[model samples]
Target: MKKLIVICLFLAGWHSLLAGSPRNIMLILGSADPAVLQDRMDVALRLYTKQHFDKIIVSGGCAAHGSSICEASFMKEVLLKSGVSSSMIYKEENSKTTVQNYVFSRRLKEADGTLVMKPGDTVYVVSNHWHAISVAARLRKYDNLEAKFYIEGSIDPKPTDKLDYVSIFNGEPDNDKFVLKGTWLTPQAAWQEGDSTHYLTGSLVYVTDPQNMRFSVYERRKVFSGLEPYAAGRDLRFIDAGSSWYVWNGEKLLHVEKQERKVRSILSLTDLIPGLSPAWKYSLKAGAIYGDRLLLFSDSTLLVGKRKGKIFEIEQETAASAYFRNWPYSWGRGNVSAARIDPQTRKLYLYRNQECLELNAGLKSVQAPQSLRLKWIDKSK
Candidate 1:
């Protein structure tokens, strides 16, 4: 009798496991290119026809083309046209780069505030063949060994894959056509200020190369000069704080007016954080601005602080030896100048000397670092 009872219990446990199947989630990566976007949609459509998922997440951000139309939004419009129901599709518009595509998409939530992605769920990453390895690596690192991942590669667009931009924007204003105005350049430091995204780029033989550095302002698809040849020294770095701008002037942090280019000293960072002084030892660099707090990255540490009245208070400190280990050239050697945050997403971006890293709101986990670029589209074409 005891042996029979054990067998029955084992069978019941197996039945429970089989009944609780993992949810299927298809993550369609975003692209600004009409051809690429069409291909991704095509792949998603095919996958949906074969195996319908609980949710289809389209991921991309406006930083891709620098216009109001984000990659996810554009992809969503086409997906709807392609017969994918609005109920099944979710747009993730906070991702500006490939790393962001995975990071932001996973955090997507349902109407009930429950997480769309959960442990034991199966996530299908739909992207081009080129992103297969990179996507797999990110999935392993970010998924925290909870979920299973599959990559559906759309190597190239089919001959029949045609996108109708006219139909997509039919009901909209004729002047609101999206078009690229100029060449897209990789920036040393990038940040979002108000309605515009700013890039600090130039010759970077030093941390803040004042001799050749200039600020390019991207709004929509139009690129223009935000600051034309602003004068400063080698020890200067620009930080953006939503509505205003601040600068680390080698010795003290200062608030600067964009239009007038006037500066007021805030406080000496070295005095407040002694570990960051003596440039040779620490190679201190301002990383990004989060709310009222300022984030600074050194050779081996990530120091976060907030200004309280007349003094600056240290908030948190974490060992960032691993971050610098991957970036060997150090701070001053590369273009470690411009750092910014996306106003809509609240994700902090650290434009280092080598690559760009996307940090979550809490500054805890970081998306795999990659080159940072901004998209500018002339919507008023």
Candidate 2:
């Protein structure tokens, strides 16, 4: 009987040890309100103290006045005051955006070796209640780490405002209708919907292939009310009204248009990159420039020409290959831009005005080039 009782006690102790092991906690701080942010931090610190996480990484960057201090610094200060040792708290202060917070925090591991954890190592990520989903999705991209999230309660005790609730539910903030920043490639003609005559604040409309709707309209002004339609059998052109026209191919800024559009002087890859030359010009059936290659789809064949000294020369060696004969799987009516290649994933990402799409190799896939491998390393010290 004495031996059996000892065995039962040992099992119970082992279970407790397994349950109580510390997890690596990453806390994301949002907003610039000092009082509210501090309240959230206080809640996190208390939770950390109770659960006893192995280490804490605080994330945030510069904000408005009175809230200008980097969030990580403020968090580190609070943790130190709350009795968490300096050695156990890590600060990631350079991240001005939420995604950057995760990227920079991973970078912190280099300075503090303790931040490195192997596979199966549990991690706890804390962020505002509404932003939990996006943060989780981003973290899920990393196959090596497993993470759970906690949301700090809002400082305001009142019921969440209707707009605020909607924003949180939609995975963004409630302050703006739809924030439109950065240049966009839109069709010259678009169908306008709704009775407003002017574009509604958050009106949704299809740009091209009226049958197969594309991007939605976010913002519209009196001068730019209607949607740009898809002109078939006609050349599609864009005339920049601004003093300096910046031509963006939906990914990177390609070149600046200085003169008006005319047959003699047309926008070419040579104008964007200083030393490239234009080998030939077609009547604009399907033409686009990505990196150093000028791709044109015409006469049931795809032509890829190389740029050399302000001149483009067609590559005759592989000209017979039909790689891009049926290229551009889909082009959004709102923006006809090329996808931006992610160095980490080597996959092209397309941003159609408001929406985003990931370009894959497709049904019959081909191996990716060696250059696009994941280069992330454990920087934890």
Candidate 3:
């Protein structure tokens, strides 16, 4: 009789532990299209109502060519309209890819540094049927919780849907919007030092010193006080996106090098660096000029044009290819809004929204990104 009583007590304790309250979380991956996003919301809403999910996590950032607002913001808006309480919804607004969705969502923390989704919690991922497999795979890799998938069967994935490799910048869809809103101090300061009015052409600061019969090139607005000797009839125009200075005149492009105090003309941009497509000019997002190479960043590509003594060559890689795979969550969407290389230190600085990331000379991340705010002088005040 005593043995039977002990067995009953042990079974009761096991039942209590198994029935502990584990939060049910509904994670909705985002889409760029409003119609598609609404479809996803419908699925999430149905699951939430039926299963009584404790929370919903909306994940995605502003797409490279999508609408102005981020995907998470749009999803949250739809969820609110459907009468889901704001307190039950959490937004993961920094993710732009499927891999990032799982990575960022799992790392979200509460006010007291506790994980938003604890170990025993259950996660239900709601996405299109085509995307469900990848979502499930990521959930298995990133989270140890019990996960269920709710896929909307109506929407089908297309071959043309290359969103997996899409690169995005923070803020508005238009790339030029960030520069247009502010009076940049770099170009203005470069012009002041050049003693001539200048304007930005492509990424180079073009300062025309007509009085001295020469043109000056400031690598992305790093100011040089003096001017170089000009070839009188040939008007030196914008420099190519390479370490070796290649100037474009009306007739031809010429690569020029400096020996001590004298500048020597060498070759043209096309002559040295082969396979440079004409489309590169239109796709240019940002660039930073260094002593040994020039780093050019486009929406989907990074071009490293290296120069050694007199030889020049170009190497290309997709922005989302390698570096991004290693640090998916921290790098945001694999492309930057703006880039600059410090002349003295050779450190690379990438700007995205209100954050700045510093990379060492070997192109390795130095530390966590720092908060960056562009402060303009309030002349009106």
Candidate 4:
């Protein structure tokens, strides 16, 4: 009887340990206005009273006004005032945007190299109601995160920012109503979603049939194809159910999705990087969504976004840095601007100027780049 009782107790203890193993509470920063800051803190204190998490992760860089103060630091003051134990709070002090909040905080890990918030850990995101929508959208992109989100209202509400976010959810980039336009080929972004090929040509977004290159429908304002750079599977667990695509139309940032078809892997670069400029004014220097990661190439730095709650970065001397060396004014067109994965899963292809280079799957090395053969592209047009 004693042996049997001991076994039962052991099982109970193991289950308890599993339940409390990864405790993470993340707070998204708000305006530095004292009243707004206090409101955010009040919401956090309320949640803490119910269940004090192992770590309270506060993220945000500045409190606006170009002051030396950061949002995370401002929030820390509120936490201390609210009586949250200093030991239990972890401040992510360098993030200025929502994406930075998620990326920088997730990089924090324990001494043994384990992530502070593991796959099964619960995450609580506290933000203003409007900001919380974008917050939830960005957070839910992580397939492994088990997050519980909460939003608070500002004491003096600002409708402009709030309405802008609403426009994004509605699939309109730049917070403007979708406009119609003519057929053109100077595309802002081009992607093959599922079997259908989509191109945001000029001011319009277009979708083509897989079997026969025929018009299916006009996906207006959906041309910011840079958003979901990686769609490899038939995954459908986005925070917003109606989202069929995510695109960035110029200054208008749409956290929208285009569910025109299904696939095995999907990757998005938006809200994944610490500091990213998805605006059309400053397009990504080079980016690709291959497999579960969105590969971004800026200068020599490469950022890999992992869907399983972690980001792994790879830095290497790019092969294209030497490409087109023989050509005059190579600096204008020689740099690699994009990458694509071969369906066979054996190699990756990178585009630079007029050449296409093939690399091993791991992207550690590459073959000599060859001039692209555009057999189908009508140069006459």
- Identify the candidate with maximal lDDT: 3
What are the models' TM-scores? 0.37, 0.35, 0.40, 0.39
lDDT of 4 by residue, 26-84 (tens): 65555546666667777777777887577787765543434445567678888888887
- Which sections of candidate 4 miss by over 4 Å? 1-24, 62-65, 154-381
Residue-pair clashes, model 1: 10
Ordered list by lDDT, greatest first: 3, 1, 4, 2
Ordered list by TM-score, greatest first? 3, 4, 1, 2
Model 3 bad stretches (over 4 Å): 1-20, 157-381
Two-way TM-score contest, 2 vs 3, winner: 3
Candidate 1 backbone collisions, by pair: 65-375, 65-376, 66-220, 66-375, 189-338, 191-340, 220-377, 221-376, 221-377, 221-378
Find the 10 residues in a row with the least total lDDT in model 2.
Answer: 369-378
Q: lDDT of all predictions, in order shown? A: 0.54, 0.42, 0.56, 0.49
For candidate 3, the 10 contiguous residues with the lowest summed lDDT are: 183-192
Q: After aligning candidate 3 to the native by TM-score, how far in Å is the CA of 334 from where it should be?
A: 16
**For candidate 1, what is the lDDT?**
0.54
- Residue range with the least summed lDDT across 10 consecutive positions in model 1: 175-184
Query: What is the lDDT for 17 in model 1?
Result: 86
RMSD (Å) of each candidate, 1 decimal: 17.9, 20.2, 21.1, 15.9
